[model samples]
Target: MLLKEIKDIFYKELGDIYPKEEVNSFFYACIEHYLKLERFILAIQPGLTLTKEEEQPLFEALSQLKLEKPLQYILGTAHFMDLELSVNENVLIPRPETEELVQWILADCQEKKQFKLDAERSRSVISTPLNDRSLQILDIGTGSGCIAIALAKHLPNAKVFALDVSEKALKVAQKNAESNKVDVTLLKHDILDPELDPGLDFDIIVSNPPYVRELEKEEIKKNVKDFEPSTALFVSDEDPLLFYKAIMDFSKRHLKENGRLYFEINQYLGKETEALFKAHNFSEIELRKDIFGNDRMLKAIKK
Candidate 1:
């Protein structure tokens, strides 16, 4: 069948399901992934045709889309911070809001130069030449290791570690670390556990944990609600601050003196999340907004 004909059918079938621009973008992505052709090629080659074999998966993908399955899951990959990451049902697809969170962390770290150890060896400050010390960063509830891997890539003098409750999510996160060519330690730790060990001290502890209140599920998109892992997305409405509380408790024991703690919080509870940090005796607390101006990120210091 001709490429234009199939493209027309794709739009007709999905236009009701998604916005016009999104459907158009997805159509091009599908062509590029399946046919190995650039989007402009479709425009230039008006008579472009697809063989029956080549069209098979395109139709299959369309069927999945009709079911509201996320395109990232259908493609088996997602791009975060311009790094292509392998994703599946076991992991939540990385989002732009989280990317903003990463940018915030990177900006803050870059603004300061500390008496850190050299990258060549893990030696003391005296023994190793004073360079950008490898700051220790721990990402709690790292579903796909996006934040951890991005930090390792951007912060050359930082050792990044990630913790998650799900072993399956850790597997995906590990693959992403390898793909990104960054060294990130992955650990299976349930931060919510009352007896959870607050392991080694860290210069920074950041988490984009399960902050979505259960009552807010209805506000989520069908794609996210139907496809993404609920464990990585939600908290009990009665106790919406569950993960933030646990992380605060963990930071108390694990964060170094004057160390920083960061969180991507629910917009509705920004003041409440900030209050938790204050209650925990965290100083220099700052609440910031994302591109949309929603209260989306929080930063605090262990004083």
Candidate 2:
């Protein structure tokens, strides 16, 4: 089967599952992965044909696609900040919105340096070396380790730690750290629990913990509810904000004074998250939008 022929058959089987545009996009991605061809090359060489050897794997991969498995899981890697991360059912896939949280943190750092006018003056004011030196970050529920691994790669001087309750998740995180060739500490710990690792402090604490309400399950896509880890996606209806409360309380003891807290929040609970953080005396709490302009990220500073 030629590459063009594969595209025709692929859409015939699954085009109704996706829109015309999405089907096209998936066709390009599947061909790119199978052929290992650059997008520009693929474009320039439109007449290029696939040998039967290449077509065999293409059909196999496309079969998975027809099943509606996530493309990241199909590709065996996801691009986060240009770094490829291995993703599987054992870990939650990294979302683009969480990438925004990382950019927001970097922007805040740059803004602070400009506001102080003397980076040295800003450096002199803090007790910990994190303020004077580089940030040390801790990510609770690191999932696929995208947050910690991206930070470790992007922030040259900072040390990043990825923590998760599931040993299976940590194993994925550690593998991502290794594959990225970035040094990130992968630890097995439940952030919701009070007695975790004796209060070692961090300059920045971030998480995308479970915030989905049980009632909202009907609205979520079946792939999400059926495939993603339920423990990493859900909270009790009795306490929809349980993870937020626990994470914030944990941050109070684990974050250095003035250190920041970031969360990828459930949109419906934005106001509730804001009030919860405020009651905990967290300063400068602000809700920011996801790519879709939905309330998604919350930032706070420890007093």
Candidate 3:
């Protein structure tokens, strides 16, 4: 069939399910992934024809999209921090808000390094250099290793580690780490397990833990609610702060003096999350919003 023919079918079938522009974008993205063509190649070469093998997979992906399956999952990849990551039902699709979370951490870490350098230069203490001082970071419940791998890539002086309860999730994260070409130590850890304590020290501890309460499931989209792994997305309604509390307690035990803690929190519980840090004697707490102006990121210092 002609390239324009498939494009027309994409618009006709998916326009109602997705916005017109989104359908157009998805059509192009699928073509790029499956057919090895650039985004506008079809438009430029209007007479392009797809062989049977190429048409089969593209049509299958379109059918999945009509059922509201996420395009990222159907494509088996998601872009995060300018890196293409493999994603499947085993791991949650990386979101833009999580990308914002990563940017915040990177900015703070880089700024802190600069300030330290400036202070040394002012004091004429040339003996210690930035490269000599290494940072250690631990990411809890790293779904697809997005945060940990991004940190490792950007923070050249940092040693990064990731912990996840599900071995399946960790397997996916491990592939992402290798694909990103960043060194990240993956550990099988259940943060909620009372017997397991993070005994190691870290300069930075971060998490985008399971914060969605059961009551909030109704608010989630069908694509996320039905297709994504529930264990990575939910907490009991009766104890919505379960993971935060555990991480805070764990931070107290494991975070080095003045070490920072970061979380990508639920927008509705910004104050409550901050208060949890305060109750645990954590200081310098700040709750910040995402690009959409929702309170989605929090940072605290263990003093």
Candidate 4:
């Protein structure tokens, strides 16, 4: 079958469901993944054709797309911070805003490391050598271990750990950490359990937990609402800060002195979320907007 004909068929089938540009993107991605062809293949070889085997995956993906399945799940892979992660229905697909959150943490780590090096070189303050103890980081609700693996991969000097309530999610996270060649300790622990202690002090504690309230379900897109794991995305409207509150309490016991707490929060409740940190005595509270100009990230420091 002609590749261009399949592309046309994709447009004909998905054009009504998605925008024209998105349809084009889906077709190109399908071709690239299934056929190992570049997006510009059509431009270079306008008469290109596909074998029956090559055509099957593209058609199958198109059928899934028509059913509003996410492309990442259909492909069983997602890219976050230059790392390609395996994903499935058990895990939520990583998003751009989460990438921004990871970037923010990376920038902060680099800046702090440089400062420590400069201070040591100048002999301004006597302190333990940086190598004496590795930086400790814990990622809560690590559905796919995207944040934890990225941090471990980038900050080689940091000891990274990730926690999730779901054993299935932890299995996925463990696989991702291994595939990414990063040492991340995956723990099956529920953050909401007040009595269960993680039993470690972390230099950094971060979470992108369930912040989407029940009242906001209608605001979510069909693909996200229908396909993504609901437990990873939702909270009660009456207590939208349930996870945040529990994490705050956990940080009180688990976060080291002057440690950092980061969260990817719901856009509509930025002020409310920040207030929780303030009430918990976290200093240096900062709420950041994502590329879309939405209040989507927050950072605070343990006093």
TM of each candidate vs. truth:
0.93, 0.90, 0.96, 0.97
Pick out the ten consecutive residues of candidate 3 with the lowest summed lDDT: 124-133
Error of 4 at 130 (Å): 4.5
Q: Which candidate has the highest TM-score of all? A: 4
lDDT of 3: 0.89
Query: Of the candidates numbered 3 and 4, which has the greater TM-score value?
Result: 4
Better of 1 and 4 by lDDT: 4
- Every candidate's lDDT: 0.88, 0.81, 0.89, 0.92
The C-alpha RMSD in Å for every predicted model, in order, reads 3.9, 2.6, 1.6, 1.4
Clashes of 4: 0
Give lDDT tens digits, candidate 4, residues 66-161.
999999999999999889899999999999999999999989877877777889899888666444137899999999999999999888778999
Pitting candidate 1 against candidate 4, the one with the higher TM-score is 4
Q: Rank the candidates by lDDT, best first.
A: 4, 3, 1, 2
lDDT, candidate 3, at 13: 96
Number of the top lDDT candidate:
4
lDDT value, residue 170 of candidate 1: 96
Clashing pairs in 4: none
lDDT of 3 by residue, 1-303 (tens): 888899999999998888998998999899989988998786588899888888999899999999999999999999998888999998999999999888988888778768778988699656455441378899999989999998888885688999998898999999999998989999898887766765679989999998998999999999999999998899998888999998887887889999989999989889999988888898999999998999999999998
TM-score of candidate 2 versus the correct structure, residues matched by position: 0.90
Q: Name the better of 1 and 3 by TM-score.
A: 3
